[model samples]
Target chain A: MSRSVTANLKTKYLVMTKKVIFIILALYTFSSWSYAGGGWPVPKGGFYFKLSEWWLISDRHYTDAGQIDPNITSGIFNTSIYTEYGLTNRLGLVVYFPFLSRAYVNNVVSGTTGDLLIAGDAINTIGDTDIGLKYSLTPQGSIKTAVTLTLGLPLGNSSGGSQQNLQTGDGEFNQMLSFDAGTSFSTKRVTFYTNVMMGVNNRTNDFSDEFRYGLEFGAGFLDRKIWIVGRLTGVESFKNGATAAQVNSTSIFANNSEYTSYGAELSYYLTSKIGFNVGYASAFRGELIFANPSYTVGVFLDFTK
Target chain B: MNIFSRAILWAIVWSFLSCIGDDIIDDRVDPVLRITNAIDTMEINTNYTFEALFLNHVGKEEVITLEWNTSDPDLMRIDPDGNATALAVGVVRIGVKGIAPSGEAVQDEVPCVIGNSTVNNLKERKAIVKTTSSYLLEGDAVLQEMEGGFLKLSLAENYKASTALPGLYVYLTNNPNTTAGAYEIGAVSVFSGAHDYELPSEVKLTDYDYLLYYCKPFNVKVGDGKFED
Candidate 1:
C-alpha cells in the first residue's frame, strides 16, 4: 500500500512538471509572437509591429585573384521582432530585437586542406538591437520620405567563436544614419510600392564603417490579401586596421569584402491583420566573402491602436 | 472659430513644416565616400591589381577617375591607365586621387617596396605540341601509332608567374627536325581526336615539357625541358 502511494505521488509530480513546462513553452511562444508580429512605420500616425526573418545567402567566397567561386556559398540567418510607436503624424520611435545564426563553408581553393568551416550556435538573445527615431521629411499624398537616426547597442553574444565570419554581433557600439524613401501607386486590382533605404554604419576596431543600401519592390494581389516582394541589397565595408601579426597571418582574408544580395518573398494575409511571409535570397556575387543562399519564414500581425 | 484658436492652429502647421525642412536638410548632406580598397604597405614587385567600383551614386561611372602618383617618381610610376611600373628598387609612397563626378577629389596614399629582380637572363619561350598524324588511345597503357614528331615547349616550369595582368602565347610547330632553335608554326587547328596519343617506344619520355599551372593574377612561366611534377 505504501509503494502504491509512492507511485501515485511520483505520477503527480511528473504531471505537475509537464504542466509547468507546457505553460512555459506556451508563454515563450506567445511572447515571441507578440514581439515579432507587429510594427512597420506607417504613414502619418499608426503604431506598427513586424517580426521578420532575413536569410543572407552567398557570402561570396572568391579565389586569391578575386574571382567568384560558384561552388563556395554561405550566409547568416536573422530573426527580428520590432515595434514602432508613432509619437506624432510625422514622427515615430522604434525598438528591435534580433537573433542570428551564422554558418559558412569554403570550397573555392583546390584540395580539402584550404576548406573554410564556420558554424556557430544560434544567438537568441538580444543582439545589436537598434533604437531609432524616424521623422518624415517629405510627405506627399502618394510619396513619402523619412530619415532615421539609430543607436545600435552590442547586447548580444559578441564573442561566441572566432569562426563567426557570420557574426551575430559586431562586438561594438554603432550608430547608423539612414534615409528611407517610398512611393506607392494603386489601381483597381493591384497596388505597387517601392522603397529605397540607405544606411551609414559607424563601428569600432573589430569592425569598420560600412554603407548599406537596399531597394524593396512589392505588389499586392488578390484584393490586397497576397503580396509578392523582391529586394536587392548591397553592402560595402571599410577595412579595419590590422595589427602586424594579423597582416602576417594568412588565415584572415580581410581585404575588400563586398556583397550584394537579391531575393523574392511571398506573403499572404489570412485576415486584415495577420499574415505569413517566406523568402529566398542568394548572394549573386561578392569579393572576400562566403558563398551560399539563405532562406526565411515568418508570421506577422499588424494593427493600429 | 475664435481668433486665438485660429492662431494656435496656424502655429501647429508651421511647426510641422519646419520639421519637414529639417529632415530634408539632413538627407541632402554629401554622402561620405570611403575607399575600402586602400593598401597600407605594398611591395612594388609583388604585382598587385585591385578594382575600384563606385557605390551609392549610380549611373556615374564616367564621373570618377582614379589618378595614382608615387612619392618617388624615379622609383615607381603609375600611369593614368592604372598601370604601376617599377623604376628602381626602392621604397615609395603611392597616392591615388579619386575624382568624383562633381569635380570633388579625394586622395589616399600608401607606402610600397619595389624589389629588384636579381636574375635577368630569363627568356620568354613558346611551345606547340602536335601529333604528326591522327592518334588514338584504345585503353590505358595501350599503343596507337601515328606520324613521328617532336613537341616544342613554349614555357619553362621554373619561371615565376605574374600575379597581376598576365599575357600568354600559344602556337603549334610542324618542323620535327629543328628541335634546338625557336620555330614558329602556322595556323593551329584544334579538334577532337579519334583516340589519345600513346608514347612511342623509341622516344624518351623525359624530354617532354610539363604544363605550368597558375592561380589568377599570377603569371607562370615554365622552365626549359622541366616538368611541373
Candidate 2:
C-alpha cells in the first residue's frame, strides 16, 4: 500500500472511535459535496449518470453548543441528476442538478384548543447546481490521485414562506477545491477499495468558508455485482463570516453550521451497466443543523463498465 | 419488480410521505383574571370604576362577566359593575373573579388604601431572563414605564445568547408557553451585551407578565422571564 492510503486507513480507524459532530447544511448541496468521486477520474470516453432522490425530515436540531433542541417539524426533498463524462485521458466533467426541490414546515396546532397557531407552509423550486472538472494526477499508479474544482451556483429560493425562514439554498455562490487519493486491493474473494478526501470551500455573501474531509470504504461481493459502502464525512466552519446579529436577513439556516456524519450504502447491479443504490446517513454530533437521518434512493447507468 | 422499478416506487413513496403534517403543541396555560386599571390608593369619598381582563387557557383575552367584591364592604363598597366608593380611611382588598371558557375558575386581588389621593399602581418590574432550552441565553431585563405612557425594555450588559439560534425573536406575553397571542417586540439582533427596545404607548409596563424569547420560524420557546411581583 502507498503511504497516503496507509495513512488514510489509520486516520479512518481513529475517527471511528471518536464522536462525529457538526451541521449538515443546505438541502441538496452538502449531501453530495462529500460524495463526489474517488481518486480515479472517469476513463477516456467514459460516462456515468445517476437519478436520485434525497430527503430529510427533522423535528429537532443540534444547538450551537452541540446539544439537541426541539424545533417544529420540517422536511426537504430533492430529486436530482448527477453525471460525469470523461473529456480526455485525464480530464472529466461533472454535473449535479436538482430539478425538483421541496421544503416544508408542519403546521403548529394548539393541543388544548385544536386551533392552528401557525399555518404550515411549503415551497417548490429548483435547488442549487454544481459543475466541476476533475483531473487525474496519476493515471497509471498503484495509488491513484485526483483533484477537483467545483463551482456552486445559487439557483434555489433562499428566503421562502411568510416568515422567510424556509430555504432551499444558502443564496451564496461558492467554489470548492478538493483532492482525493485511493487504492484498491483484493483479499481472496472480496474486492475492496478505500479513498480519502479533503477540500476547502470558499463561499461568498458573508457565509463562512468551510473545510471538508471524508473517508469511504467499499467492498464488492457476489462476483463484484453487489457492493457495500461505508462513509464518514465532516465539515468544519471557519466562523469568519457575519453572524446573525450582524446580518439583516432573518434566515433560519444561519452561517457557521458544522457536523460530522456517518453513512452506509448498498448498491446492486442488475446488469453490467445498470444498477440501483440506497443509502442512509445521520450525524452523531452537530451544531446548528438538523438532528435526523437522511435517506437516498437512486438508479445509475454506468457506460464506463 | 425490477430494481429500477423498485427504486422508482421508493421515490414515489417518499414524495407521498413528504406531505405536510400537523404538529400539536401543549400550549395550555392557567386562566387568569387581572385588573388592568388598578390603583394603589383611593381618596375618601372618591368614586372609581375598575376594569378587569380575563385571559383564557391559551392566553387569548376574552370578554367575560367578572364578579367584583371588597374585603371590607363597610369601608369600601364595590358593585357588580366594578364601581367602587371609599366611605372611610382604611385599607381593603379589591377582588375580581371569573370563569374561563374551559370552565376553570380564576380570580385576582389587589390591596387598596384610602388615602389623600388616588395613585396609579405603576412601578418598574425586573426579571432575570434564562433559557429553557439547551441554547445559551441569559440576561437581566427591566421593564419600566416612561413618559407619554411608553414602556422601555432594557437588557443588562451581562446578556448573552447563542447567535446561531436562527430567527430568534423577543415578545411581551402573559403566557410563556407559547407566542400565539403574544405582542411581538421584534426580531432579536443584539445577541450579547446591553440593548433596549421601546414599546409603543399602547403597551403598558404591567400589560405582560413575562418577557418571551421565541424562534419565530420554528415556533418554539427559547427562553422567558417572569416579572418579579
Candidate 3:
C-alpha cells in the first residue's frame, strides 16, 4: 500500500506540471494577439513607409568666440518618404527619399540681402538620401534593442544658388551610426512604450561633432486603435573648426549653438496598416533658428507578412 | 518524474516574471515635462507679462509655482508674478523656475536686451513746390531755398552735424558706439515739380542722428531786367 501511495504522489506532480505548461502557452498566445491589435513598432517580417514633413530651425554657428549674429532663423520644409523591408526576423533594409526640400530665410539684417545673403523663394529639390540596415540585437518578450548604420549620399542639389549657405544639401557625404532600443507593455485597455536612441555623425568638414538624443512615450485608447505620442529631442555640438566667412557676413555672433525641442504627436490607425499623424514642434532657445513654432503632418503605411 | 517536471515548470515561470520586471523598471521614468506659455526673453526698461501651464504624467493640468530671477541685479529685475522691469542697457539672463506638485523642478533661461531710451526728438518734415510753363518763361524760380532746405533733422544734446548742406545729403559719421547704429533713410519726389514734397510723419531722435536733405534750386523771376523777389 505504501508503494501505491508513492506512485500516486508522482502522478499528481506530473499532472500539476502539465497544467502549468498549458497555462503559460495560453498566456503567450493571448498576449501575441493583443500586441497585433495594438499599433506599435513593426514586428519581424514587416514593412512600413512613412512620409513626413520635418521643419527645422537651424541654430548652427560658425565660430568659437561667438562673434557673429546668433539669431538667424530659417525654415526648412522637408518631405521625406522611407521604406523598411524586413530581410529576416532580426534584420531589415531601409531606403529614404527626401524628394522635396525647400528652405527660406526672412528678416535678415542689412548688407546681407539678395545675392549677398541667402534669400528668395523656396528651393524644392531632392536632398541627401539615406540608405541603411537595421538589425535587432536583443529581442526579449517585452523589450527590443536594434542597431542601425546609415550612409548619407550627396546626390541632391547642393550647389544651386549663389548663397553657399542656402544649398539644398549639406554638400559632404556622411555616415551615421545609431542604436535604437525600446520596450512595450499593456493591459486590458492601456498600453505603454518607451525608446532611446543615439547617433554618431562622421563627415569630411570639421563641422563639430553632433549629439542627438530623444525620448518617446505613447498611449492607446478606443480598442487600441487611436494613440497619442509625445517626444523630446535635444541636439548639442562642440565647436571644433574655424568660423566660416559666409555665415558670419549674414549674422552677428557665431558659435556652436545647442538646440532642444519638445513636441507631441497624435496618430489614428484607419486600419492596421494605414494611419495619419500631425504634430507641432518648437525650439526653446536657438540663436540662428526660427523664433516661431514649426508644424508637421504626415501619413504612414505598415504591413506584416 | 515528479521532481524534474516540477523544477522545469518553476524555472519557466520565474523567467517570465523577470522579463516583466525588467520592462516595468525601464519605463518608470517620465518621458516628457510640459510647460506652456513660458516667457523666454524680454527687452530691458520695458514691462512684460509672463505665464505658464504645467502638464502631469497623464496629460492632466497641474498647479505649479513659478519663480523668477535674473543673472544681473543692476541690469533687470523680475517678480514672482511674472513682472519684468529693465534697469540698464545690456543683456540680462532671465530665468523661470517651475516647481511641480511632486517636487520636480524645471528651469529655462533667455537673454533680454535693455535699451538706453526711445527716440523722441527726430522729426519728419514735408515741403511742397509748384511750377508752370509761364513761370519758366518768365524766369521765375519754382521754390524758395531755405537755410536747410527740405532736410530731415534730429537734434539731440551733445549731437551736432559736422557740416551743414542745403540740398539732399547724408552724414558720413556713425554714432552710438555702445550698440545702437543708424539703420536706414529713404527719400523720393512723389509729386514732381507741380506738387508738394511730403516726408515721413514721425521720427525718433534716439534712433537716428543723421539728416537726409532733398533741396531744389530757388527759381526767382527776372522780368524786363528787374528782379522780382
Candidate 4:
C-alpha cells in the first residue's frame, strides 16, 4: 500500500527469488542425506534416476537493510533430472540439471488509480547444472559413511527477462565436497534413520564461497511402501560478494547470504524400486535471502541387483 | 524417536520461526522540491527565473522536468520551467509539481506578493543542480550565466550532504557519473548551506551536461548536479 512497503515487497517477491533458484535447487537436488541416493554407494552396476520439480514464492526477504515486509509475490518453477550410476561397490557417478526453469512476477496495481504501477513478467530457461562423484567408505556396516565432490555449471540465464529481477540462475561456477554419516533403528512397523553432513564450497567470479551442513531423519510407512523424512540445512557464506542497495538493479545473490531451513517430505513407492517424493521447506531465519516457503515433488527409479 | 517427541520437536522448530523478521524496506521515498535562491516576493512588471529544486526517490537529488502554476493567475503567472512574471500588486501562491515515471507525484508551494517595481535587474538564465547517486547527496544549486562568459553556481540552503565521507571533488563533465571528460572544479568545501562556484569562460555551460561530485581515491560518486539553460 505504501511506497516502502511496495518496494520491499517487489524486491522480495521478484528480485530475491531470481538468483535464489540455484541454492533452492541445490538443496533439493544434492543435499539429501537420510532420504538421499542410497547414502552408501550402490552395488557395482547398480543405478538410480530421479526427476524433481520445485516451486518457490516469496513476498518477504532478509536484505542488507534487514528483514522486509510482504508486498510482492514472486515465484519460480523448475524441473530437473538427477541420475547416479555405480562404477564399483564403493564409487558412483552423479549428474543433475534443471532443464526447465521459469521465473515470474505478478502485476502490482496502484490503490488510487487501479492502474498497474509495476507490470508482471515471466522468463523461462535452463537452470544451472551440476555433475559429481560419490564414494562409500565401508563395504558393509550398521553405520554408513560416504563423501561427495561436485562441480557447478553456469548453464542458466543470470541476465534474463525484461528486468534484471527476472533471472533464473546465479551466474557463477562453484565446487563443493562433503562428508556424510548415517544410521538406522527399526521397530517392526517403521525404520527410523538419522544422517549428518558437512561440506565446503568453492566459488569464483567475485562470489563468496560457503560452508554447508544438513541433518535429517527418515522412517518407512505403510509396510515399507512409503518413506517420510524431515531435514534441517544451514548455509554460511564468506561475506565477500558485492552488495547494491537499489531493489531492482544490484545483485544480492553474490552477497553474504545465510540461512537455516527446515523441511518435511513424503515418498510413496508404487512398486519396488519406483517412487515419488513430495515436500515443503521454509527458511526460519536468513540474511540476504528470501524469507518464504518452497514446495517440491520428485519421481524416481531405483535399480538394485 | 517416538511420535510424541517428534511432535514436540516440530513445535519447537515452528516456535523458533518467530525470530524471523518480515519487514522489507522502510518506505517508498517521495521526490522533494526546494527553492535555492530563497525569494519570497517580487515587484510588478518585473521578470524572474524561479529555481525550483528536486530530488528523486533514492534520496539522491536528480534533474527532472517540472510544471509551474500560480494560485491567482491574474496577479502573477509562471511558465513551465518556473519562470515567473508579476502582473498585479496582489499576494499569490506559486507552486511546482512533477510526476515520476512510475506515477509517483511531488509538489511544493511558496508565498509571494507583486508590489511596485524595486530596481532594474539584468535578465539571466537559471538551471537547477541535482545529485547523481543515492545516499543523501541532495540540494538544488542555481547556475546563473553572467553577462560575461563567467558563471556562478550556488548551493541552496536546503542542500543535504552525505555524512563523514571524504575526498569529495566536483567537476563539470560530458557524462553524469564519470569524470573522464570533466573540467576539474576542486574539492567540495561545503556540504549544505549557500555556497558559490565561479566557472571559467573558456568552456561554456553547453560544454557538458553534468556537475558531478566524486571521491577521487575511491572513485565513489558522492553527489552532483547538471548544468541546464
Candidate 5:
C-alpha cells in the first residue's frame, strides 16, 4: 500500500455521519493491539512473527457514572507473542499467546504509627491466549478487506492472587468476529493510509459481551522507509455482567472491563526484513478497568516479504 | 530516527513526567475529630469538659488547639478551655474543633441536657467489647442515647486493634457472621487509644446485639463484641 489512492472509493455505497460515528465508538473499546499491517494479508506460505510488551499502572478508575475516582493502585505487565501463517492467498491462521502476565498493587501505610494499614499482594501467571482464522476478500479497486474469527482460551491464572480482584484472567471462554477495511493513497514523498475494524464479542462467563472497534491513520514517507500511525480504539459492554456488589466478593473477576483509548505507533525499518514497532495507549474514559495509559514495544520478523 | 519515533518518544517521556499522581492515592481515612467522653445528658449547673479522645490524619497533636463552642450560648456556655456550664433549662450542643499544623480541621458535637428528667430520654452505659475472633479488639465502648437526638459510640482509653488489617468497618449488627442486617457505622477511622462515632437517631441499639469490626472489601469478619450493660 505504498501508493496514494482515494480512500473514499466506497462513498457512493456508504455514508459517514456524526450519529453513525458516535454509535460505532460508543459500542466498542480497545483491548488488544497486535499484528498491525498496511491493508495487506500475509502472503501465501508466508510466516510473520511478532513479540511485544505492554505495561499498565492505575491508581484510579472511572465509576459507573463515568466519573473518575480513586481506587486500588493496580499494576499489570504483559509480554505477548503473535504468529500468522498464510495457508492460501486468501486464507491465514493466527495465534496469540501472552506468556508472562503479572499483577500487583500498592500498600496503604499508616501515617500515625509508620505501619502498614493495608496489605498488598503480587501475582504472576500466563494470560489468556487466542487463536483465529483470517480470510481475505478479493480486492475491489483499491479497497482491501478481511474477516477474522477468533477464540479466546482461558489458559491464564484467574484465581492465583490473594484477593479476588487481583486475578490475571477472567476464567471464561470467549468468541470474537471482526471485519477490517483499509485504503491507501500516495503523494510525491509520502503515502497515506487508513484502516478500521469492527467486531463483536461473546463470553461464556457472566462477564458481559461487547462491541469492539478500531480506527488507524498513518503515512509512509521517503519511499516507504518510515510509517507513522495514530490509532483510536473502543469497547462497550452489554451491561449484563455481574457487578462486584452483586457477586460474593470472593468470586468477582474482570466481568465488564471496558475502555475508550487512543494512541500513537511508530515503525522504523532498520532493514527490509526487520523493523521496530513501539506504541503507547491510554484509556481516557472507561468502566471496570484501569483508567491509565499502557506502553508497548515490539520487534517483528517478516521473512516472506 | 523516523519523525514518528521521535514524536512517540517525546509523548512517552511527557506522559511519565506528568504521571506524578502515580504514587499519590487517596486511600487514607479523612481527618476526623472523635470525642469519647460525650454524654447524652448533663444535670443543670453541672460542669462538663469537652475533649477529643482520638484525632485522625494528624501526625503531631501537641501543636493543634482544641477549641469548644456551643449551639445555644444562652442555654450553655463553653469556656476557652472547653468547659461547659449549663445555663437555662433548655437543650444545647457542645462543639469541639481542632486544627492541625497541616491546616486540616476535624470537628464534632454532642448534646448536653439542661432540663428536667421528664423530657430527657438520655441514657449512658459502659459495655466491654471483647474480640470474638483472633484479631485484637479490646476496649470499653460508651453507648449513649442523647435526650435531644442521636446516639454516641466511643472506645475506651485502653483500646487497640491489629494494625495489619485493611478496610475495617464498624457496624451495629445482629448477626456477626454476616453484615446482612446491620447499621453501618462507617469505616473504622481509629485503631488505638480512644475514638468516638456519632450515629443517627434512626438506628436503635436495642435492634442489634453485637458490635462488629469487619473488613468490607475482603468480606471477612475480623471480630465482634456483644453489647452488655
Candidate 6:
C-alpha cells in the first residue's frame, strides 16, 4: 500500500511538471520571433513577422592575434524585416531582408591646426539578404530537432565612399546548413528552454568558409507575459581565403573574420499577437572583427496564437 | 497610433540618426632645428655656407632666423648668417639655435675638424622599424641619397609585416604621431623580405625624420622608424 502511494505521488508530480512545460512551450512559440525557428516549426498556415533595426558603431577592432587595436570610428546601421511562414506542419520558409542599410566613417581632423585631414563619407543601399527553408525532424518527441538550409545573397554596396573603404556587405554569395536541437523543462513557477545549433557556411568569391555554433537559453516569467533570452553565437574561419596583401584592396572588410558574441534580449508582450523586444550583444573574443557592441530594437507579430 | 505605423516611424528615426561626425587626433611633436647641410671636415682657409631647417611644434616647416655658434672661436668663426670659416687646424662643434612660434627654443650641433678637404656628411641613414600597435611590424629601413638627387628607401631582407592589414602604406614625415604633413610614398605591396621604394628627385634626404607605416583607408598608424645615424 505504501509503494502504491509513492508511485501515485510521482505520477502526479510528473503531470504537474508537464503542464508547466506545455504552458512554456505555448508562450515561446510566439516569443522566438527575433531568432526565429529554433527547434520548432510553426503550425500550418501560421506566420511570424518582425520589423527591426540593428546597428554597430566601432572605433576599434580585433587583430589577427585576437588583440584590440584602434581604428577609425565607423558605423553601420540596418533596417530589416524578418519573417517565417509555415508551408506545412513540419516545413517552414524564412526570410531576412534589410531593405535599407547605411555605413559611415568619421571625419579626421588635425588636433594642432584644426584642419580637416580626411573628409567623412557615407553610403546608403540595400543590405545582404537571407532566404532559408527549415524542416522539423522530430514532430512529437520530448527534444525537438530541426535542419535548415539558408542562402545568403549579396545585395548591398560592397565598396563605396570616396576611398572605397565603406561597405554594407561582404560582397559574397554563401550557403549555410544548420542543425538545431532543443529541450524544455520547468521549475515550480518558472519555465525554461535551451537550444544548441551548429552549422557550416560555404562562401564564394575568394572569401573563406566558416563553422558556426550557438547556444541559447530562455525563461518565461510573470505568468508567461514576459520572456528573457540569452545566447552565445560563434564563428570560426577556415582561413583558406586570399590575404589582404593578395587582394590588394584598401577595404577593411577583408576575408577570414571570426567572433564569439554573447547577447541578451528582453521581450514584452502587450497582447498575445503583438510584442516588443530590445537586445544588446558584444564580442568577448574576436579576430579581424569589430571590438564593440551591437544593438537591436524591434516589434513582432505572431499569428500562431 | 497603430503598432505598424509606430514601427515605421521608428525605422525612419533610426535611419536619420546616423550622421557624419568628427574625430580629433593629437598630432603634436617637439620642435626641432636641423642642420640640413653639415660637413664632416672643413678645409683650412675655406668658407662654407650652412643651411638650417626649423620645424614647429606640429612638425611643420617654418621660416625662422637661426643664430650660429662655434664651440671654440680659435678654431672656427661663424657669422649670424651661418657662414663659417676655419681659422686653425683643430676640431670644433658647429651649433645652431632657433625660437619657434610657440616660444620653444630648439637647437642642433655637429662636430667638424679642419682637414685637407671638406667632406659632406654621411649620405645614408639607417633606422630600426618597430610596431607601435598590436600588429606585427618590424624591419630595418635604410634611407640613402641616390644619383640625380633622388632618395631611395630600402627595406632589408629581415623585414616582415602583417599581411592582414589593409591599405598599408609607407610615408616620410617629420612628425611620428600623424600623417598630416607627411609625404606618402605608396602602398606597400611587399609583406616580407627586401624591397626598394624610389622617391622623386625633389624629396631631399633630410626632409623627414621618421618613416611611418600607416593604413591609408583606416587612417591609423601601425609602426614608425626614426632616421638614426
Better of 3 and 6 by TM-score: 6
- Model 6 per-residue lDDT tens digits across residues B1-229: 9897889788868776889899988888889999988889999999998889999888989999889999998999999999999989989999999888899888999999998899886798899999998888999999999868889999999999888888889999999888878999999999999999999988888889999999887777899999984
The lowest-lDDT stretch of 10 consecutive residues in candidate 5 chain A is A17-26
Which of the two candidates, 2 or 4, achieves a greater lDDT against the reference? Answer: 2
Docking class of 5: incorrect
Q: Which ten residues in a row have the lowest lDDT in candidate 1 chain B?
A: B19-28
| lDDT per residue as tens, model 6, A57-103 | 88998888899999889888888887777789778787878788888
Tens digits of lDDT, candidate 1, B1-229? 8432443344334322321000000111121233223343445454445334332122112336677677888887777644677667777777666866555565656566666442221122233222221111011111112345332232222222211111121211111211111122221121222222223344322222222221111111111122221
Ranking by TM-score: 2, 6, 5, 4, 3, 1
DockQ of 1: 0.01
**DockQ of predictions, in order shown:** 0.01, 0.62, 0.01, 0.06, 0.06, 0.62
The Cα RMSD of model 5 versus the native structure comes to: 12.6
Candidate 2 residue lDDT tens string, A202-242? 99998899888877777777766777777788788999888
CAPRI class assigned to model 3: incorrect
What is the lDDT of every predicted structure here? 0.41, 0.76, 0.41, 0.59, 0.60, 0.76
**lDDT at position B168, candidate 2:** 87
Per-residue lDDT of model 4, residues B33-98, tens digit only: 655443556879988887766655433446778888989999888899778889999888888888
Off by over 4 Å in 2: A1-35, A252-254, B1-13
TM-score (0 to 1) of chain B for each candidate = 0.31, 0.91, 0.34, 0.43, 0.46, 0.92
Model 6 scores a C-alpha lDDT of 0.76
RMSD of each: 27.5, 5.8, 28.1, 14.2, 12.6, 7.1
DockQ of 4: 0.06
Query: How much does each candidate deviate at the interface, measured as C-alpha RMSD after superposition?
Result: 24.2, 2.0, 27.7, 13.5, 10.9, 1.5
How closely does chain A match the true chain A in each prediction, as TM-score? 0.68, 0.89, 0.70, 0.84, 0.85, 0.88
